[model samples]
Target: MDLKKVERVYTSYAGVYDQIFGKVFHEGRESAIRNLNVQPNERVLEVGVGTGLALPMYPRHCRIVGIDLSEGMLAKAKERSEALRLTHVELQRMDAGAMNFPDDTFDTVVAAYVVTAVPDYRKVVNEMIRVCRPGGRIVMLNHFRNGNKLIAAVEKVISPLTKHLGWRTDLSLSTVLEGTTLHVARKQQVNPLRFWALVECVNAKNGYVVLNGAAASYANGNGAAGYAHGNAGGHYASEHSV
Candidate 1:
């Protein structure tokens, strides 16, 4: 990925980014964080922590270290952290695919709406799991290939243009999580218009099992609601009734 180009675009638009994508972006973000069930004093690391949108949602007692590839984004994130008076949060410019932290350094790792932005998402995911403790969580809030034919068509049609605009419409969350140790804990469709979603997962074995599913009802309350049926293709979607 062209870090210079990414930094330039984000820096130039930082002032208006919130106003432009605020509605769709904020909803998915809030839902993702809420479903995370983060506890106090947890050491958390946020990859691609652009503008520090999740900083305010974190517990005050938790320690947070945010990293982004774009210096422009990190600058805005620093401003947000200061504005929120989050003394425990730190912002730095770093690549998501290559983190500087030690292995198992963080109790929890978060990546919100960032999978699509990074050039090498698989490497980034592996890096996230590598830094997280054995029993810790990895939460993701992102937009992916919705099973709807109409939306899929639209995504395919505009994907080329969207890619130029910093959007990777081709990467699906379902495929992204495949064969990874991060288990899906909870997931909900944020909004169809934006194709956004809130998904939570935990690291386990060679592949991640859905931790919030019927097998582990204690992980999250959603499991007790009974397993909701969906298509067999592995893609699931839930309209934002929240």
Candidate 2:
């Protein structure tokens, strides 16, 4: 997944991206924000905020900084922000692998449909963790390699072909979290056929559990406070289990 190619592919899709992905991925976007559970006046950063489809869904009280590498996509996002009169939103064209923000700059960091699209998913994830404050939330909404062996094989075969469309199909959740201080507090399967995943992690570099509400208060029996499987009412997965 070359960065230049990804940019070109999204630039071409910018005009119709909302129509193609808006409704299909709407539920996952909404779920990801809900998992974020942002507080008033918190600083939030969104990577790969293509077309800003999730813009209007965020609470207006929190400050939002949305970034993407594709200029064409950012243009559409700008239009959406203006039309919605979202004064709290800010849009910038920036690389996900190399964000300009300083460490611990944001209260929450989100990346929807972003993990598999970048050239180096690990680099992007590391950058996300670097910018987000310790104990803050880092929400990811995207498809991971299926757990079923048969499906995983099929995805591996199709991954090369999908790269041209600006995403890969064979990335695993464990692979994305490798070597990171992020702890998977919750993960839920969303979208049609449950093809996509909505994962919420705590930036646990400081060893603090900071997620709020019932989701955070519910004990997982392992002493953790979040659910591992949102649909099954499962216990929370350990830090590396996601």
Candidate 3:
């Protein structure tokens, strides 16, 4: 994808983007944050942190660094951070495939709806894990290829159009993790589109497990194991096995 074109598209939509797509893409934001399990005062990094939607949900005392490729998105994110008084969160305009951070620099790293957007998904994931502490978590909320054959067929049909519309319809969450050290700790389906999924995993560990079934349901204020909708801003809380 052309970097300039991507920047232009997002920049053009930055102001009204949330209003138009928030309900659709922001559903799992809170869940992704909770699953991160960041401790107070820990260093955290969020990739593709559009408009800083997750900023308000971070542990209040933690230091957060957010990176995105779109300067237009960062401008809105900066306004949001300032408005919410999120003094600890910093925003930077950077590409996900190429990060400027050092190795093992953060306690936790997060990527929300970012995998599909980047041309090189694996490279970005490797970078995310590289910068995270050995035992740290890499929490993600994204759209993937559902194992259902019928759904996969439909996704294939619309993939070209979806891609043209600024969405990647073919990046399977499971496929992307292949040959990597990231281990799946939990997973849940979030939408019928068979695209949105919530996944919690640790970097380079054995005894990996893939959750096979429906999305989880939970009561209010529960934790990481609950039902979450969309991608970023909404999620039901519940306890999860990590």
Candidate 4:
């Protein structure tokens, strides 16, 4: 993928992106964050932050660093920070595929509506996992290609044109999940059309296993296992919910 072209596409529309995508994907974004259950002192990194639409929603107690390749969008995000008094949120202009952070730097890392737009989705995902500490939550809120044959065919036809607009319409769930250690904690269909996917995965490290649909986290040093289960109201039990 041409990085310059991708940068240009997002930069050109930084001013109008919120109007175009804000409400359309708001439900998924909200659900992802709620499920994340970010704590007061957690360090969170938001890749492909773009215009900082979710900045205002983040907990004020936690520290949030949002990065995007588009300088224009980062500029808007900065303005949003000041305008909305989001003191805890920081915005930067950087490529998500090649972030310059140390290993295990963040407690939780999130990517909203970005996988399909990145030049290399796998690289960005691995980077997100590498920077996140063990037992961290990796959340993604985006529109995946429909599983239905006719709808998928229509999405594929439109993706070529849509990619130029800074996103794709035909990104598949399996395509992104392949070769990743992240496991789905829950999968929900959001939005009025029910086309968007709210996928939450746990960034489980060494000695991880899922039993009976719940993630049971067991590390070498601990005899106590962390069991997480899905709660009907949306949020999962933190650490030992199962």
lDDT of each: 0.70, 0.82, 0.72, 0.77
Backbone clash count, each prediction separately: 0, 0, 12, 0
Residue-by-residue lDDT tens digits, candidate 2, 10-52: 9999999989988999999988886665666778899999999
Best-fitting candidate, measured by lDDT? 2
Error of 4 at 204 (Å): 2.0
Per-residue C-alpha lDDT of model 3 across residues 168-203, encoded as one tens digit per residue:
776787688998877665677664463588887655
Query: How high is each candidate's TM-score?
Result: 0.81, 0.87, 0.81, 0.86
The candidate maximizing TM-score is 2
* Clash count (model 4, backbone only): 0
- Sort the candidates on TM-score, descending order: 2, 4, 1, 3
lDDT of 2 at 191: 87
Candidate 1's TM-score: 0.81
Q: What C-alpha root-mean-square deviation, in Å, does candidate 2 show against the real structure?
A: 5.8
Whole-structure CA lDDT of model 1: 0.70
Structure candidate 2, residue pairs in collision: none
- Best-to-worst order by lDDT is 2, 4, 3, 1
Q: Model 3, which residues run further than 4 Å from truth?
A: 191-195, 205-242
Instruction: Summing lDDT over every window of 10 consecutive residues in candidate 3, give the lowest-scoring window.
Output: 219-228
Put down candidate 1 lDDT per residue, 54-88, tens digits, no spaces: 78987786688999877776888888888879999
Model 1 — which ten-residue stretch has the worst lDDT? 217-226
